[model samples]
Target: DEMAQIREFIEIAGEYGLAYEYINCALERHPYKISGKAAIKLLEVGLLMGFKSGRENDKRFDRR
Candidate 1:
């Protein structure tokens, strides 16, 4: 069920979207400067977890 929803979302939104906007404003308010890898791990955006591999055992959805 969850996988189906994710596929539908990707089909609709594609692989790109408003990834930046007022990002500087957000950074200005925040003290920590996160790396690209670290940012993907953040669950608020869920970019990492949101993408799942066919194998449920693999948490990062890495392709083998």
Candidate 2:
């Protein structure tokens, strides 16, 4: 039932401006296998890194 429940979790995450990411782990196999939780963590890490980098560049912008 995990597949059925994933959508529910994804929607909940979206409400908080977050995303549920999915990655293909079995590309060599006939049918690709998806890594669900791992994808989520990867996305979260990427987003955090992007935000941190952006903050470091904040000095380049001038409101006035």
Highest TM-score: which candidate? 2
lDDT agreement with native, every candidate:
0.45, 0.42
My TM-score estimates for the predictions, one after another, are 0.23, 0.27
Over 1-64, each residue of candidate 2 has an lDDT whose tens digit, in order, gives 4344455556655422222222221233346454888667765775664422223344454232
- Candidate 1 lDDT over 9-62, as tens digits, reads 457655422222123234546686889886665433534335332335655645
Where is model 1 more than 4 Å wrong at Cα?
A: 1-28, 43-64
Best by lDDT: 1
Error of 2 at 35 (Å): 1.6
